[model samples]
Target: MTDRHDHPAAFVDDMSDRAEQIADAAMRLFARYGFKRTAVDDIAKEARIAKATIYLHFKGKDDILRATLQLLGQRVDALCREVMEMKAPFAERLMALLRAHHCTAFLSIGAGDHFAELRAVIDDIAVKERKAFESIFVRYATQLIEECEARGEITLKRPGVDPAALITTLMQASVGAKVGGISYEDYEARLGLFAGVIIAAVLP
Candidate 1:
């Protein structure tokens, strides 16, 4: 019979830290070598952990990928919140938000062939998480639009243009610009221009 009390209070914390280290190593490998080519042994070697130790934290490669995506999602969410809380004007804040999002996406997927490989590896999970995140993002954008309008920061040129629809279009355009081969700094500048156009279109 083993005594569970033999383990120190830091045992669980240590395990969690080890799990994060493993996930970080896996992310680097996934970025450098495509997910299919990155084996558990490779991750273990990168993290300097025994191959069996990975099992203590993750079921397998798929599970590790899921964990890494979740971490990425949390970081994006935090960035969004930070931008939303800024003291800048609505247009400036919106531009900042779009820039943060695009920059984060580029960093996450633009390194080597990570995006294509990620799409191939966990398409379903990726789609589900993306849709969920986008839904929340759109809602927040709508709220910002409404607040801006109320504050006279913007006024709709066409009263028929639904705030939600306009926000969705802006979000899609921002993403499309990135996929269309524009450089990061250029994309960011375009985001500022886009936000200005949006505000101009709605200005009284």
Candidate 2:
């Protein structure tokens, strides 16, 4: 029920740029120190802006956390849209989607040595935002799978191969890969193989 725009200074013309700076700084600090240990002053110092300046575009630390997660979500969504818009076969498009998802996961969650700590911080403050973003991701994946099936690009061989479930399983596999400390190259290769296997199973 709390509208972000209800804040008096939220409408500044340069708000988007400022918010990006604040979020970037916050993400770095959160990665370095964990969320509970990072303070607004730390972000302000890292961003080279006054603490009050951050508040001009965000309500507080939690707001900044939400904004940061939203930015990441937007990046993933953009990648999904790009894959969907490609003039390629459904199999190629699906591979592209899986590659994009892996790349995004690597950048967002695997790049940092302290990612587990950072993830815990985010989970505490933005569980709903995370869940919503994941739901959108799953929806996109499901749409792609259904479209492929409809176009005769893929046929469901297994009796109950739900697209949503398949996508969810893939997502969990990617998370496990990251948590297991697999190198990005290794993870991508594994994902490529996994995608191939999934496509092969459903191929007519």
The lDDT values for all models are 0.74, 0.77
Writing each residue's lDDT as its tens digit, candidate 2 over 48-144 gives 9999898888889999888877777777888899888888887788778877766675766455566786667668888987787676668778888
lDDT per residue as tens, model 1, 1-204 = 855457766677788789888988887888778788899999999999999999999999988988776666677778888887888788777777776665676566544545555656667555666665566567667767787888888776586766876787787776655555456677677667777877777767
Per-model TM-score on C-alpha atoms: 0.78, 0.83
- lDDT, residue 65, model 1: 83
Q: Lowest summed-lDDT stretch of 10 residues in model 1?
A: 108-117
> Clash pairs of candidate 1?
155-202
Worst window of 10 by summed lDDT in candidate 2: 105-114
